[model samples]
Target: MIIKIFSLNLRMQGKKTYQEKLFACFSLSERVPKDNFYRQLGGVLDLEYLYGLTRAYYGTSGQESVDPVVFFKLCLVGYLENIISDRKLISHCSMRMDILYFIGYDIDDELPWHSTISRTRQLFPESLFEEVFTKVLALCISKGMVSGHTQAIDSAPVKANASMDSLELKVPKEDLESHLQKIRHISRMDKPHRQAKENKASKTQQTIDANKQELGAIKSRNKNWSKNQDQRPGAGNKGSKYTSNKTHYSPTDPDARISVKLRQSEKTQLYESAKCRHCPPCHHRYSSLPCR
Candidate 1:
């Protein structure tokens, strides 16, 4: 039994989880003299010109000075390659030497706090992201690889930040109020929810089913609010959504839509084919799409 356990442990340990592979492979075998992520970036973008264009927001008089270029590069990569959130991005950088090298941070350096990353993002406008993208495209143009004849674009369904199980379509007056009250009560009591500790000792998944069930019931009571609203008194109710369909999607469900669409961005006559805006990459393009 001890050997069996030992064998099982080794087998489990052998199961490899992929760290994010840098797919925007700025590196290649027959590399040109100038070949680094930034070099590749320069080949695809005009970094200095865009940075010059970015309106710098001065930090508070006493706040510690942050390296904006570093912060911007971190954010740029975070978007170019979709990681779910700033936390995951920083976590990857904290562990991966390649990411550390790309970001110009030391391998041993402590990762920036997730909150710091989020706060820094709020300091700039969306134009920064657009400018950065365009700069890269400019480099792609310089490489004489910019294709204007044909374009390919597609869309996919992505899970939203909010859990569908946590959302209600109609949210009846009584039900919405009830949930608000329940959450308030929980907040007031500040009950300790040590699910992690309990699971370790008991070797069972500590249940949040009760809370989840309660939320689910509230959602059911909302009575396909979207459907009902459209039918009730008509003013193009097809678009009348209190929240998004994706918002109610749950990350836990294996059956949930896994969105991964790749397409070519079209070329346009306008010098600026991109616009600047700060947004979570997953939802950014879909912002123009209707709620449905």
Candidate 2:
């Protein structure tokens, strides 16, 4: 019998064979287009510089650490994707073939655990991240995306734990709960007398005296409530703690000072004062422009 070989034949054929394999030959990079965003970013970002910065964290002779370049690339992916959760970042990168190609991971390759990304972040200092930011900013400037000459500044005061209407005179530090309890007690005791005076049909000397006493109690209550307004009911969301420049110092910002703005009728407002520490060393104030 003579066997015939035809190399030019092209036809679809079905085979009754059970052939299942664990792996197949594939190229991730070739599957992704050259003009892809991650592809361009990979080419533009020079992550080799990170080696020197990360060298101290690794030892010369131990189990290898996750590649710093890959780690940072993943971080960039998170920012570009606007994914704040690390676990979601890993899952997102894993499912996308283009991202996998950009990160140089094979289809079947398992991604590094999400916890590794957090540990890597804590390992790197802020200064290193700042350095990377500066480089990226320079790149943007080179690309004409940003101009170094002009910058918008914010002159508005930062929101703090204290308020303008809550200013109090500095006094001896005392228990805030105790003060609140005492005020509440006074509130309860004076409630009946104030109500009775209001119910009186005619104004008399005794009623006038009661009215005077009620006014005094209300004045004192308003004064204390202004300083620790956060502690009072209807102040804010439930269980919110109160702090004042007089009784309590800001644990987060100890340098903050208290200032006051006096209004008509002797009403004063308390303000948590802080200066802009990040202002340029030499800047000219443009007072001519009206507030926007």
Candidate 3:
């Protein structure tokens, strides 16, 4: 009985090997289900007009650019997938059969280079993008996917690539430690153990951008924040100190500004993209509509 069981176990064990083979009949359209989200989206979204609208942007005598329809579909995929990086978006699309079918690419076809997507985006004007957006919004409205009754504008703090340790004082001559002690009370745990190896911010960025009145307001706020924080439980263990963009700038990323969330003791450096502001309030009013 034991020998028989051992033989059966060996028979069940398997190993996978790599091999390549050509198929006589294979189709992406057939493989993807009818109810797939990309398939449904492709059915409802008609981007054929993009060719005529984008014809003026291209000249008659140069290498052909990326298909405007494909480019816009790629952008839509990126937005729907919440992929911020073009390289990652292309990589993601390559692996998904449904996405490939929606974007009109076969499994064997090579995708456009990620850099090409970036260049094409820069080549197109903002008005073209707005027109595309308007068309999609209009389609949504027609489908009862968006109602014009309510508007929901929302924002969240996205962490910047910079680190808190890379922060530098606006006034170069003032000692950071002495400055912190003067403006706000710091517990032993709140003290920084290390300093940035180098300051990369330009002289202009290091200069104070805030006026005297603004500086005074920030100081007053910092003092009040310290007093309020001391009364909270576990305040002694919190390492974050009140930081304002007016007084400090990130040497690693000059564009990053310091921000903190309500009821959160930790500070974060934030850098919001200008693209988020492109959607006007009038368009946003229909954002709360229900999809049928």
Candidate 4:
């Protein structure tokens, strides 16, 4: 049998030049697909009631604010897209045709400034947000997307804005040295550093409220934690020693409390440095211990 060999040629296109063009017939609604998520969401979600709900929050005079419906739609987009930053969310929304259409803005129409979104969010009360959430949840329930019978709550600890290094020992009525000797596992090599630049904590917060029994328990837990931590990698790292909310607090954020969570597979303890807001007394009591 005779054999034949074939050669294939591939064509490479040249660099394309981009330029802006004006078109009178351009329409954002037509550009986005009918089945697009944003399109369907926009069609089903009616947020016009927000005008009446939030009318009291606005003034009758002065400059006009961002549309309530548009602002909320942008927030919904951010939540659905998992965008945590306002600046980033605005930039991302500006780049998407579907998002612009969903928010009722044309290609040339400018989205509200990121700061406007933040200010608008703060302007609305928590009750307003809850009401909006309830309405959305009801919509979902009606659409058969939610069972409305059962709900699961997440108790995961979120990382705070405070740093571990900024933690300061809580002052007790007793001598400072004696108190430190009781609770802290001070390494010989650990050098003393300058005190916190500022202590924002009130006088009541500065003093340790934990009783002797609580202090003793903390001391015992610190000793064991220090011993086990020495076996782990980066053991000598600063801030590796266990510090409890019962003994230490962040000077930068007085309300922030230290929380710990353990990895099941590695059996290693991970500390969520601090909480940005004040937690309840019951929450603070359990937050110091390692969460499963």
Best by TM-score: 4
Candidate 3 on 155-187: residue-level lDDT in tens? 666778777655655642335456655642332
Off by over 4 Å in 3: 1-19, 151-153, 160-257, 261-292
Cα shift from native, residue 93, model 2 (Å) = 0.5
TM-score of each: 0.41, 0.51, 0.58, 0.61
Candidate 1 global TM-score: 0.41
- Candidate 4, 66-142: lDDT as tens digits: 99999898889998898979999999999999999999999989889999999999999999999999998888778
Q: Report, for every candidate in turn, its global Cα lDDT versus the true structure.
A: 0.46, 0.57, 0.74, 0.69
Tens digits of lDDT, candidate 1, 59-120: 44676644566677787778766785988888866775555665656644576788888887
Those runs of model 2 whose alpha carbons end farther than 4 Å from true positions after fitting are 1-21, 148-223, 226-292
The alpha-carbon deviation from the true structure for residue 82 of candidate 2, after best TM-score superposition, in angstroms, is: 0.9
- In candidate 1, stretches whose alpha carbon ends up further than 4 angstroms from where it belongs are 1-46, 159-292
Residue-level lDDT tens digits of model 2 in 151-240: 444353333443332222222123445444544343243222122212212222112222555546544645665565444321222332
lDDT of 3: 0.74
Tell me the deviation in Å of residue 52 in model 3: 2.2
Better of 1 and 2 by lDDT: 2
**Which order, best to worst by lDDT?**
3, 4, 2, 1
